[model samples]
Target: MPCDLEMGLDNNEDGNGSPETKKIGGVEEEDGDESVGLSRKMSEASICAAEDDEDEEGRKIELGPQCTLKEQLEKDKDDESLRRWKEQLLGSVDIAAVGETLEPEVKILSLAIRTPGRPDIVLQVPESGNPKGLWFTLKEGSRYSLIFTFQVSNNIVAGLKYANTVWKTGVKVDSSKEMLGTFSPQEEPYTHEMPEDTTPSGIFARGSYSARTKFVDDDDKCYLEINYTFDIRKDWQSS
Candidate 1:
């Protein structure tokens, strides 16, 4: 099938939305194991699935209270992409940024998000101090991509040594629910993980990774900080 793929490049070490997800292209995969390895293809399929559902008014249909057709489509897309990326891209794809040194203009950071959309939401960073965070309303069950990238000081490694998308949910936006999805870039170079469940209004994620630090030969600056740029898009319907 033909599909549209989104690609993003983030210079920040912080896991924030800096790993921006943008549609890159359309790829048609031949049926077989080879198709599984092509993330660009899988993402295309995901996008198509998302585009398939919409009411005449352009709003997503709802089968249940607080549930929308858009959300369901995203849930399916996440599952399909995660499975395909793991089976196909893990060994062959190359994200060479994890091991190389970044330039002086770049920064390092990580990403975390909370659900429930109010004072009930929270964001956390496992590698650094947690800062006052921002909130984006994710339609229940919709698919959201967390594009993760890193920077280094030396060209030791080409890209990310490891990248993971993990989730923890709760009955009250606390750590009490099940982990919906987890993807690790261990088998290959380029891959995408299925996002965790966000349909319950209490599920969120942590996009975390490490990279080579850029430093001077002799300088007092010993710490690294990453910047996150959030790109939130809402169409006429989503609004």
Candidate 2:
């Protein structure tokens, strides 16, 4: 792969009529190119890993100082201008109703499955140790989506995230993570739907898949975790 001979650039001589490397502004030597290339690749990999860790360690990110919404709203009530601005920012959310709790409380009430041109199949979220198991089936190559209805109370939930991992026969097939942004306690539950995806179309891909999903905030406080199983079949499963 060395193109020095092809480009007629094999002249590894110095300016003093002695043997030296071509400087090309002296950024690096010809012999160090391989090392530089390897270092660049390693740096890129490190960046990718750091990005992944960033979601898990989001609470540690500094944003000056942190305070509850109640505290922030009460911080500077004397200044009418500032108070109005804060009111505009918080909107009609009643901070006084969030109570005196110090940490956020989140509840995922339901999970719904939606297929194009079909009614949504709403499923109740099961308890952690419920003796019963939750299951569903999807047709191969059929597009479907998942929706979560959740509520945040007590305080603001920062960097809310949803993570799901799928496995088939004990081997992980896919993993997905998404930041659901921050949420303040409100009277209404929040509904978020993930992008739709098609079931893989193949005999090997059609099988039972177990998935574990978790909802957590920046503090790593898990709001909910669910383990469920589903099947990808050749045809839509009848109710």
Candidate 3:
């Protein structure tokens, strides 16, 4: 898929190269599926086909918010609470599940680009327990988009609520720390286990999504991530 032309475009001109008379500063253009934030999730168009029609091919997927956890947290300056929560999550993130120490931070200067022959995101249907197809891009600097529907297992939703509660209660930012921290770490890390209640209530089973292109340390390597939370409790449904 092509990255939106507006990905890094200056707003001062139109597609035809005519200067825009508007002088608005800090003005963000509304993306076709604009509800998703800086990290675009999946587009509304693709979302409809995948969730509503049960046609899995309609959902295209990609890798992630490729920045080191730290950079991802810092990018959103306006959401102070979210920034802090992200930092805490990053500080405690376990990559490989083998206790490899994550780099404290990632800088564009450190990323090395090399061609790799593989697809990133894979979409699957739980009922089939098999992947439909892998999401791929023909080039490095391209945008990938898709719609995703997950049965929000109760355990996952509970974890989200707990995390939100922790972030909302008595959190503070400390500029001097090498890695940001929020609530104290629990003795045991949370599990990604689904609970018995995590079934399709038609409430949190499916929904619309959108996303934008993301570059991995380079200005060209692109990826995407979910920009907004789909609570499944209220707004979940096929688009």
lDDT of each: 0.26, 0.57, 0.24
Q: Indicate the residue-level lDDT of 136 in model 1.
A: 32
Candidate 2 — worst ten consecutive residues by lDDT sum? 1-10
Best by TM-score: 2
Score candidate 1 by TM-score against the native: 0.22
Instruction: Give one digit per residue, the lDDT tens place, for model 2 in 1-239.
Output: 01011112222223432112212111222432332221111121111223244445464432223466767666657767656544553455676676356677889888888889888878787677121443777777777777888887776665576766777799867665555555657778988776666667778878777777778755556888777777778998777
lDDT of 3 by residue, 110-221 (tens): 1111223434333322232222332222232323332222221101011011010101022311000000011112223322211111112342222221221121211112
Instruction: For model 3, state the Cα shift of residue 39 in Å.
Output: 6.9
After TM-score superposition, the amount by which residue 98's alpha carbon in candidate 1 deviates from its true location, in angstroms, is 16
What would you estimate as the lDDT of candidate 3?
Answer: 0.24
Q: Please state the error at residue 84 of candidate 1 in Å.
A: 30
| Model 1 misplaced regions, further than 4 Å | 1-129, 133-136, 158-239
Q: State in Å the error of residue 152, model 1.
A: 2.6
- The CA root-mean-square deviation of candidate 3, after full C-alpha superposition on the true structure, stands at 21.6
Q: List the residue pairs that clash in candidate 2.
A: 14-20
Error of 3 at 38 (Å): 8.1
